[model samples]
Target chain A: MACETDKALLQENIEEYIKDDNKVVTCKWLSLMHSIDINVAKRALHIFVHHQRNKGGNDDINVTFFVAGLGKSKDGDLMHKCAVVPETELEVVKRSLATVTSCHIFSVQKAKLKDYTPLYMTDYEVIKDNIDKCNRFSSIKCPWVSLKSGLSASKSAQQDVVKVVLSENKGHAFSNKTETGNDSPGSKTRALAKKVEPKGSITSMFASASKKDGGGNESSKPVQKTDAASKIKATKKKGGVTAFFEKKGDSPLKQKDVLLGKDSKKMDASSERFESNVTNEKKQDPKRKKKQAADADEEAPDKKRRRRIKTDLFDSSDDEDVEAGEPEEPEEEIEEMEQFEVLDKGIEEEHKMTEEEQKEEVDDSSLTKSAVVGKKRKRTKKVVSKHYEDEEGFMVTKKETVWESETDEEDEASVNKQEKKSHQSNTSEDMGKLATKNTKAKADPKGKAAAKKNSSPQKSKQTSLMSFFKKK
Target chain B: MFEARLVQGSLWKKLLDSIKDLLNEAIFDCSSTGITLQAMDSSHVSLVSISMNSDGFDTYRCDRNLSMGIHLPSLSKIMKCAGNDDIITMKATDDADTVSLVFESPNNEKVSDYEMKLIDLDTEHLGIPETEYSCVVKMPSAEFQRICRDLSQLGDSVVIACTKEGVKFSASGELGTGNIKLCQSASTDKEEESVVVDMNEAVCLTFALRYLNFFAKATPLSTQVQLSMSKDVPLVVEYKISELGFLRFYLAPKIEDNDGDN
Candidate 1:
């Protein structure tokens, strides 16, 4: 009756059921009774008939076979026919057909069958009773059918209950049936449903089932209820497209914060974390780290010192905040904050580097004004050098040249110097005035001084743009 | 030594274009008979098999069997440089580290040669056994491509159902479900355009549309595409490459979650 067929039990059941002289045993009847394959039942019937004939006393057993074949009709079209014939007439029936596709024992009896009406009626009754279990012993199994025990009776009862409870809700019954079928596999189909059934229906079913039991851990009931509630919430969240858009919309705001330099404290924390992560990565490849360290020492010691000081300040502040908040807050919140801080600092540093490069270009143009002078016209070449760390942590130096012209060289030189002086004065004043208001403003002067020191050696060589174009 | 030449150089270009998107690198096995390539996509969900007979080439010669592992995108880039009417001749010596390709104009006025380094690739050759499919459908390659393209807009996976009556392609997603059914065409006058379904039993399987779209790139190589399918087996999509041989793609079906249940 289960998935596997018991051959010994099947043979015994066939022998016992055919002991009655008036009772006839059909292959379909035996298959439905023992839940064995139809072909296996037919083979068992043949063996039983053969064994009785071999007894050598009174051979009264009669066997009939089911024959199906493709035969031509009068119109020349292929006509498929299936008929039940006695064992003696099987060969004659086979000779009359074009091709015998299948020939299996149809039934076993004591007397030869005059009419097949009783056999059909009895087999129909058996099939009608076991219609739901007809596919139980089939080779191809349906997952929804096999998942439940006492499938036929219980499923009908549950369907009746669903109908009474949710008479107006069509999807409720369908979804409930799928839910009770298989949990995970059916969930995919449920997720694909266009109109999701209300959560109340699912929970109500659970509530009703629990009430029917009437006795369990009362304390555990509310916990299970809350679990179901949260699961409902999760499914609701997963079903919406707005949640995805909301997440995408939040990233640009964070980028804007980094660009505006509004959260320096957060930026410092993040940069510290970024440095730690970089050091961790460098530890994996020490040779690259050593080379980068050597390059850093040769290129910008002052910037390194500034970075160290800022990191130390950030570490001390972070320690104080952790000591203050450790007792009340969880560690996960702190970790999330650290991650956000690191991301903010990386973006902020990139933006700041671009701004510094632009300011350096402006400084180069200003310095070139003091070098070039001519009687009629003057042309000045400005070299712009950019320094950045590559992914391998090596310093990459890129240089570009810009040519400028002025009719009155001396006048332009004086004006450029004054403009540079005013810019420097304004920055220095802003640094001192807004020292407490903005930490970023305080770092500007140091960056400008470093840029000037790096660019001082290139001032002597300046060329006019007109020199290249002159047709001399 | 091994050498082969093709009068229509554009065939190689189209072949490379068809496979370059699916494979990053492939190994070409060349023998006295022909050249064949078998490779799986990066995801390993789909496999591509190509064969060309030596008789199809204008001239062919081989002293020994050779396996050349070449980067496909790079080869495609080089193939793009050849003119449509240029005669392409590929030559390589025994135990050679590089292969040379010469492109000669029809009038013998201009000639260009390019050499590419071969890589030593460790490859495991999979032995594919021939199988009898329950259902085999032959339809216009363009129509198949159109169906795959249109269904991809509705879902990520397409369910192909082949019955005695006809074959149906359907896909369901957040937007809606779309079904396209093709009945056996009654008229066989234009054999290339007729839709034929030869089936012993009905089989329905689901496949990823993204890979089907990739396989459909061979539409220009042949007018007809053959789709062979069976239950619990990979589907084969084949396109005959004119007088050359065929390009076949085998895609594993998307196993439903319930299929794993005992």
Candidate 2:
């Protein structure tokens, strides 16, 4: 492959090329034209330049050398510099640089070259023509340049395909796990086991053994285990089971509704119509029912006592009328009977009072009834008068007249029998009164009282101070 | 082996002081032409680029292309030990883990050498293209630094508006609003002190005063600071390091969510 004649011919061609004093010739351009190595071209150029200098042609020929070395930067840091300088200034340029790494004849020209741009352009044209084979004869080697070839490109494509397939499989498995885990813990564990069976055969072997022991028992045991595990996990959380119960306890109205259903049925048969009316109202406005149910639950005991006293007042008034008609008593006794009727009207008027005021009136009426029953001979008439402004801004006066009967020993037992009969009749009248009065008072001060009650309890139900700190 | 000697040693100290607060560690790429460093701040809101040509050095030599990762604060500390007139020399091997710095007193009575460990840093070189800005303003660096420092007292951000008449910097905050304007001066004998505005169009942009204040630390490096601005592009603040090279800062403008207030 080494030919001496071919080298001589390349030398002859270079000699002919340099014969023109106006043209500049570079090693890269010489190497490309002759199809030779760059280092050989550089040596050829050096030998030709020396031959010209030896022939006393130095004054006509000009040579440029490529120098690369380190030089001091402005900020005291060392920097590398590479330059092409003419032969006349080579020594001066070399001294300016701290060190010279490489220095050789880059190009030879007859005319003194002021700009190196034409030389670079000439070399760039040759390099551009043979770009694919340009680095074949060069000494420097870069690994990445070779790695960007056809074989590595195919290899990288295969790796990308493998990565995409792996990512898709991972995504599919992730989506499957989330979908199966949404419904229940027992099903979630089973789904996980099913997914892991392909990856780990040991788990599947255990599952098969458990299935063979008892087919149905296998499912039941895991369900119970998961239930216990979830319970334990819930307790391990910050709020624990108490938080779970507190959430349910927040709505006490639901619990009262359940209790009220049973209590109203067992306690009083007279209030059955009243309870039905309340249920109808609850169905009409569900939002207001919570407040009303809370009010009814709190006032349930007081309301029962007030109902019983109203019945007693009606019964005593009926007995007084019977005695007044049969005995033809004096004017005072007739006046006492009239007062008994007025007291019954007063008991009816008590319904319009606020809950606290109604509670006080119920206590007073019960006390008077019991005291009058104990002292039958001392017939006294007590008149109770109350004045208050109604919702319509009108001052209404309520007069309660309490009359005691002068009863003989024999008449007392018969009076009790007639009183029991009147008790039955008064309950029917009481039901009619509650149906009319409660329906009308739905938008009155009763609603305001329910709102005030609702707000007070909500203010008291603040989060516990301990909840602010995390449990260890 | 590589070595570089500089007579003005205090220039290195000032360069370190200007960039130490912005960059904790940076990679210096040394090539045949010069040494250049480009790095973004930790928040990625601003970038600093430094370039110094080898022609500017008194004596420089490098055998191969090398990249050295250096901690700026430690380098600053080493620089502080040298006198302002001391001659500084930097030396390193081709494949070395540490760089050596030698400080020689001008009178040759004292000399001290320090070795600093080099770190391996993963760096991505961002390509900043050459753009034609709408406005370019040249003014005394001290005046620019003073304006930045004063505006920072009023607001977190300063709005820079450049018009045909003058360049204005305004800042509004809880305390109050402050405005400073610099009109282009006529030709003067003292060129460095004169303000010059070369504008093709008007541009108004907002920038964080905190970062502008940090960039102002380079005021001692040069007499004049050059500012280039365009709509939606980062503002470029450049300070020429004498006849050596330039240190430039690229600051991303603040995006206004409510454009009604300008």
Candidate 3:
């Protein structure tokens, strides 16, 4: 092969060429260009031309490949040339470069080019994709220059300084173009739109890319698209390529929706419903505040919205934030119940005297109240709360006749719920009260004393249970 | 009658300091070899066994093999009364219910004696069989203590994996996964300072960090700590007290439920 002849000729002047003069090509420099065995530098020189393939251009331009040497300035163009034998393949060049760089070929990667991203050039795929760039030198500009056993290495070192300044200038200009491109309104709008759209568009883009890369294999297409889309999304969001493979599937929309559905089926249904109840408990006033009555009506619909949020495919981050915010809900209900208990105790003491005198004085003044106990836990709470809203209306009218001057700071909302609860307990307590009242009526004619003992403690248990659920 | 005197009372004080956080009481079995204490914590998740040889003590005397059940907190309270260099003498009758601790200060400057009542505790003595551990890693006690302390803040449990390369302590939780790897250090001037791993085969086990933190109390007693582990068996963390015997801690592994997938 032609490469073999070129490799042998380069090996002859390996030591002289490696001298620190402008021609000294170290393995460190060559490893950046291509993956090569660093050990090869110990044996021979590796010289090859890099054919620059300008995107949208057919002509392949010759670019001097400087492994670790100074470039000679000629006509304002910085070009590095070295004397070497001919017919070397890119592989031989990479092996020779690896020897100088002292880096394994598998670890090398091409620097980020204008068109393509910085890719792992260690594999055959990267080499095959950029085959045009791996061409052998067509002609040596400085053919007469020869590096013998003894030569001054200082000549090459001086030339490298000029090449370094030129490269820095080029890098600055290239970065400026990219900054302007990103700043354009058109580009900004497109990026923003991509964020707004669900993952459906990204999935299609991934499908197309996979189809082009992997050919007609449809079975593995979904998996590959998921990997690619997730990789892109993770990198975009995290601003680092390292986050690409951090998760199994991190596509923002489809995967999250799927996750939400599964989470909803598992725990979302109860947790979401729990959130609404908490929100109601927090906002609801124990006093008969008009706003509290309005909030109760709105709470019925909020529960449906919570259930809807669970069934509908949606993002969970927002849902999680709401859940964390309402942890104080349970504490509020306990506070409201305490205030209502104080009012109920005062009412019991006032009614205690009248009940003792008229043993059958079942005060029918509270009969018009909605104390209808419905079947099941849910309906019972709904019927009781609804009755409280109605009782508040009657409580306003009957306040003067019954417990006068007790209006301010009294939580009628809680009082209404407690009143319904106490009423329910009274009916149960009524059964016990009747039996006891009959014994007291026969034994000592003090039926009111026995009735008070049975009703008071049972009413407290009922109030505690009411606060425990706080069912809106 | 049973009496054992420790020349360095500070060491025994640290031994009690390490366990008082987890266990309230323990039985001290006085045997001819020395004094051995083996007991489990309240949850029965961890077992701590301490044995001191008769040769290790300055003066040791036991007429008969006796077991004295004592509350650890009360004993630790008495231990705190003794100065670092004080001579601690533990005396209890074979059939008596209370134990007296005599603390003789350095140069006999001041001496204080405390008699703490002992309870009759009916605790089953578990005979731990000899386990052929797959991996044994010897490392600096301070390093082990620091790793356990730091990683406990990250998770409730830690996974200890031992291989030919090194021993790794890994914890994964809401924050993320953290791993501390200690490779066998190259032989230096002090061999004890270097981490050494001896493996018959690789073994990986998960244990609760809560117990590990409790066991790390023995860090002050020994310079080096050894971790012996086998698959599905409790991991043993042993700290060998020079001239004395060793303090060994055994903790049950948290088994992964395959069917329940917990």
Candidate 4:
């Protein structure tokens, strides 16, 4: 694709080119016209003319493609997931897809270097979507010489600097040959797997796995496990299970409503009346169970007390100690609780959640649904955020996703949740075990006061809990 | 690679700071060989964690695993001895009480190593945790610092009164009271700091001359400071360091009438 028209003539169609409103491409098209990867133009034409069934537009495919993709993409935002700053070492090519789209060139200095304009946002999706069409590039006015003059890359990576003729994915620095070679029709649609990635790496295998097994499929669990195992093996040489996450976010939102959190457009705020209703559920349920509990209270109230305290990680440790299951059993549990507090302090300081806070989630399904009501608009936060990840850690500000991700912070949260929950139910399941211990202290009415004296130091327990939850 | 759980005393920093009984040092317990000490400075409120774990080292050798107990004075001295470009090397042998710190500069020109022995200091510190407050406002730290800096120009004593609306930092001299409202804030061409505030909670507390004078230290660390208050609760100064941690200061709010309205 080369400039056949004057710069003045093409300036007339700048508004039309900018109409697509893709934040990344709109910014990069200007750079491509003057200094695009010669292969980028050639490949884009190959895809648009051949794969997209616009084959006859070889005349216009060269012109309008860059304008539609890069021109419009930059106009919105130069959202780049992450940039490969000059000093990235040990970053794996097999697992990582290193894409440098027309968008990531935030500010391309012209021949003068002083005057510049913003370029395309080079995230995987934005580039993948618009670059498939080439007729769009025909509209742009290339101030630089034609494609024949631009194919200057000695190696593919140099395409970042040189303006290449054919806009192919070749020399694109990202994508293995086979992956990039799929500009074919059936293959083009088949390869949309890189759009939404799980496991956080920009790898082809992981990306394809996410595409095949995403959207709350129970099958995703195994895929996730396999991906996680592979990732752990890849990341930690000679690795065992380095990380495990038990994701139990607020019990408030129902499973269906939880899915709505990802579907930003589907959120309905009018249903928030359910939040106040759930908060009242506990009080209401007690009333419903009042008569049954009142009769049971006459005889130890054992079942009610056990049922009520079963879910609490803290209370279970106390119960285990009195049972004499082991002499020094509670010490380990106490230590785990203590470590939890330090973790909480760190998360609280960062405005995130410790696993402890997540573990105590009591049917938060209603609370989340209420939180996501009319307040929920059709926002593409994840998409925009993906663009900027190249600068910051690709942080998605979808509050719900972030809140959910918080539970799996280091997989420690999930481990503690299981350790605490199962320990609580251990004593209640077998009273025969507690009854076997015969070392009963001499019975005295003063036992209550003595217990209080011994437990005075344990008051730090509350503070520990606060530190764990980062109680404000 | 190694996560050592230290089951020690729980002393809440926020609670302890209320009565001026906060610990002088941060005692981080870590087992030797497979561990990480990733700390971001409290001054830069946005978090930057510095993590160097067992895997991070190419050749990590530890004969025995021991719990780490670092004191404040030792840390300060080490920071003073180390230069910016110095490669810091810490080595402690098995059963060794002291860890050696060596600084190797460029080209075998100079290398310095020093060992500081571990001292037994009581970890438990008594702190008064109770305090009541009047008001609290979470404002951007940049704006708060600007107000403090701008008002400090008028006089040394800045009477910071708060309302449900916003915080007012006013100082008077022979001229008049210099007031600044950080609530409804804007930026000019020269300045580019704008924050959308959800500041429904507000507090009006008057700080003493020297207190606001010294508070000049906190603003640079964080972008936002949540100023918490109660009539009796010491005013809480909170700032978030990006993603790392929060550094907070709790000051006893001075009621002017208590000192005969001086």
Candidate 5:
């Protein structure tokens, strides 16, 4: 049964929805169902009930009761059914209300008589049982039920894990039910085991699902959930609530996860699965390697790519000639590449890390801000990419290097975090140098890459190998 | 001091009525020889020159050269006090700030005086070089005014063409094109109805119809109007002030883009 506040919210939402198009609200149920937009459906539902009562010539009937009658549809023998709402009508209203609220309607609730789980239940019971007051629901101080999260952790987790599976099967809708059924048991157990780490892993899973959906070419099997979770964990640190449900889902468990113990375990399993999947993915499709490399190039700090390209250009000039398809001008290209390399080494330091590891490292560096609360914020665990530090200045310099160009969008938040850390006896000079390096890298890509790669261990290895061959 | 008295005040009234629409104020230079007013319309695309000799006035006197700036609308309003046959006397002391117009009825039944405020106007006086026009047309003033009024409905500008055979006033707009051609009249006894074009070469020029209609307001002042045209020069529409000189209107021809011709 709907609470007084829920009824008021419904009335206000319907009013706002119908205020624009009063004609559409008067539309018949059959035609109303055909409306693709939910606002139209909600408004049409209001008008349907309005007209229904008007047909009975009940001008004297309370508008509140008439509005409450919105949950009752006149279908077949169900006409004039006692004002107690039907489940199907609630489902219809919820569908339309989802559009009105700019969110999905997961569940509708009345004020419960007792205390429940503290995880995901938003307080919707503050409407103060006065339907006839015509009070605006907007003015009423009811904490909104976030549609992204479940009513309770256990209940919403099962639903969202199923949603995660369902979203995974969206591309292949024919096998959706079977795939969802298969994962229902495993995800249920994983959901319980991942209670503390739900936001991080679930959000990461959503990000990977969205990434999968973006790729569209890949036929996703249910087995890829662990891999998806890992990739999401990698990408979702900077991308908060990228997945639809994850935004609301993040709100729950946000307050309750004091224990970091279970979250670290979940991250390890997901990261291991991610690393395994990367190898298999690299092997199955050589084309995908180039794409992943490009994706890495896109995701990698501009400073790092500049460094990598710089090293790739200089140490192995012959290798680049073969790679870039400019055999006719090899001498000139190598000369140009050398000149570019000399200028680049004056600025950026090169480092060698796989693109995936670099992305993980970037995410981890961003997470360094929240590292104090490791257990509670599962999002902080995404900082998995830690480079081997030979010196404090050299290794820690990567965060400033990562601050270069492409990551500037996400870097703003990360910059705030870095600023707080930099205020306490950290190298402020390196921060300024890195800031200038970012601007320079933005100006001259060729110079930035060559300069950036100067610090790469990979470049040193390649150069040493070349010298060995030359000595031979 | 400057004083000029004319027998028929209605003539100045008609001239003022026609030019008042184009010019707000004008400097009337009163010399020992005559009174000459030279001014451009507000847009500077058209110029009006009124030259009246001292011989045309019943009495004329100028103590020294005086250029009096007069608002045309106010002059038109003062002229309204005079009957068609009233004697009009315009008087101003040396460096007078205001000009006085005295009107006396023909039968001495009524007399009225009007004093109008004068303003200092900085006006550029263009020396119009005299040129032998390629075409000169003499047509009935009312007929010319009628043609301008009718054709202005067709477009913003009227293209006047003078050939050996005839003179044509043509206009084209969104509604359609209209052309009124009056061939050289062969000895029409009624001279006012005749079209006489003396042409050395064929001449065609486009002048804004709005100004042409505004120039047509002088229809009440004269029986005939003379139009003179030459290539790349301003077209002149002159109404001769009988026993005086002339009230001539000079309009710059429209520069038609060659792109349209090509």
Candidate 6:
């Protein structure tokens, strides 16, 4: 059985392969068996489609199982039966799952993810009328059939119209208006940064700090640092959202439906923090800083953004805040969660932040209450970066200032992993449903859907295309 | 996309000859560029540097700037399968850490992705001397292999003395003295070649023939055999492999230390 997490990755990869007219895509199906490069598969598919269009007459030739396994035929090509002595159980399972998932994405079925099955071809027009408008046949072959179905037959171009929209918006970072240069899709960055813990040197420093005192230590530092951090964020998050909402209208959020939470308890929580978290992104790290006026401009934005996020925590503090007087203790928990979420997202976005933004996390940690007021320090000043070492004892130094030039597609695996995690969270009904469809293709081979019939000779091309690899 | 399921029962094999010189005992210290790998018969030598494109399985989808730090576990897998004729596909998803390989064995029985690891191959020893040779020669690996095989029968110690023209390999026994001569000529007339001597300097150093035989077993074929020595200085024999570079060994001649034959 494939694990839930891996299944999710398999599903996404499969879906992305078949989602569009992916008739021309290249996908690498990774299972326990040997890897099949899809680019080669596509060329094979092109040849198969070419073969189907070439032989206009349908004689029901029995060929290999691709779409053929489940007693169905694909975009009409030659057919082959399953190999008599099948591959190992694991290979059989993976191949079977791939076929089923591929069929579900290509053929028409119910709009809902659960109702999808590989049984029916989506377009009845092609099936009932026996006419594929988009496909073109240059010739026909079959001894029993009429020789009259000649050269240059064509079919209509029906672009795949059913789009696969993720059920949940898969939340993007909010109030992250600094455009911190620290940018990558949330899902991928999380997997990698999560895997690469900030433990190398800084962790040892933490251990040494605990040990250096001969066992009786200054355990009070982390708590104080946390408190100070919370205080600073409380003061900054306010204007951040106001700026984004007051102007941009966040039209992108509409399509994502991040507001999809069903419960009033959750909605109220989302809405309040949502207002601050969502709307206040407008007040950023001085989007339009004065050219050279150092002290004043530097102080304004940091204080404002932190103040906004911090205030959003207190003002909303979960549904309990609705009572006007929530207990102070529980209130603090909600505040920390919101702050952590906000900060985590900030770190996520700050992926591209110049050396300047990196210094903020480092410097802010070192600040005493009086420092922010007394110094008109330029944010870019190296002195601020130095301050962070004094405070965090150098955890921030271990992290890259920002990833500069990498593209976005590289994170697909990590994003797929994140999708699985969200499914694990079972965040919502729709999100779960959407996630389930993707996960099914990758998870266990046992519950695999039966393969449909389509003579996808694309596989032979895959083997052939892969031939050049050893030499290359 | 098309997919195939392969069962396990596949075989992959490859036979690569060292067209260049190689001293197998020196496989560890060969420089990346100095025939660290060469054809088994002194045909070609290659300087190789294997580097990871990214930290894990990541590779540039196209030619672009990518910086990835590979781990060790993955590299060993690649090295293990270098001789396999299986299909190997290393595809990098967007994540730098994500890399996958599909290894399809020649028998088509199974294909699996073995992970790749990044390692730093540093074999340059700072203080080692780039030894200057006083005497050198070119001989097949088999000839030396055979000579070592035959010389061990006489006694353990085989003395190698060289002049400008050729080398004289002699081993002494209580019953008699055995001497083999290799001259510079192709030996058109003589059934056995003689050791041509001009005597710019005549130096003899004795070494255990058993050690020489063991060294040959460890090496691939050799088209050239080079021996560099000074009276009692260590002798250096190196074999250059085509693409793999050279393998070398340095052995100090045996001396009759204080407790002779005790």
Model 1 segments beyond 4 Å from truth? A1-472, B259-262
Interface RMSD of each: 32.4, 22.0, 23.1, 18.3, 39.0, 28.2
Candidate 4 per-residue lDDT over residues B200-220, each given as its tens digit: 345555554444434434565
Predicted model with the maximum lDDT:
2
The lowest-lDDT stretch of 10 consecutive residues in candidate 3 chain A is A361-370
Better candidate by TM-score, 4 or 5: 5
Off by over 4 Å in 2: A1-472, B258-262
Across A1-472, the per-residue lDDT of candidate 3 in tens digits comes to: 8868756555434323333222323332333133433344322332322121223454222221323222332333232222221122333554443133322211111221232122222223432332322211212123443332111222222233344345445545554554454444543443333342342332333334433333212212223234322322222232223233224223333333353454223223332232233333232223323423444433332312212222221222222122221222322222222222212212221222221111111111111011211111111111111121222233111111111111111212122322323332234444454334322222222333434322221111111111111222
The predicted structure with the larger TM-score, 3 or 5, is 3
- Tell me the DockQ of each model, to 2 decimals: 0.01, 0.01, 0.01, 0.02, 0.01, 0.01
TM-score of each: 0.39, 0.38, 0.40, 0.25, 0.37, 0.24
Model 2: colliding residue pairs: A70-B60, A70-B61, A70-B62, A71-B60, A71-B61, A72-B59, A72-B60, A80-B32
Best by TM-score: 3
Please identify which of the two predictions, 2 or 4, would achieve the higher TM-score against the true structure. 2
lDDT (Cα, tens digit) per residue for candidate 2, span A1-472: 3577776776677667778435678987787777777789899898888777787734487799988787654444454666789988899889988989888889987767879888867766665555445545555444544423432332243343445456446645664666543434444444454544442332233334332322111121122222221222222222334334323332342333243454222222222222323232222224223433545544432323333443444454343443432332443333333222223222221233344433333333333433543433433343433333444545555453433233422232222211111122234545455334322332233344344423321122212212221222
Tell me the docking grade of candidate 3: incorrect
lDDT of 6 by residue, A1-472 (tens): 4555554454444334344324212211211011333333333434433454476885222212223233222323222222221112324634543243222112211122232122222222222222211111212123442211111000000000001011111212321332235434543343333332333322222323332222212222222222222222222222435433322322322211233323223323332342334333333234212211333333333313433443443433332223222122452244233323333333222223223432333223222211322432221101111011222233221111211111112111222221211112223554444334333322222222212001111111101111111221
At residue A202, what lDDT does model 1 achieve?
25
Error of 2 at A355 (Å): 35
Per residue, candidate 5 scores C-alpha lDDT tens digits across A1-472 of 4555554554454444334333112111212223223344344455535654566853222211111221223221111121212333554544432123222222222222132221121211111111111122222223442323111222233334456676545534533443465544444343333442333332333334444343111112222443333233223222333333333323322322233345433433433332334222222124324434655544432333443643444434433322231122444344333323222222222234553444433333323323433422221111112222232534542332223212333333443222222323435665565555443433343343344433221121111111111211
**Residue A212 alpha-carbon offset, candidate 4, angstroms:** 92
Winner by DockQ: 4
For model 6, what is the C-alpha lDDT against the true structure? Answer: 0.34
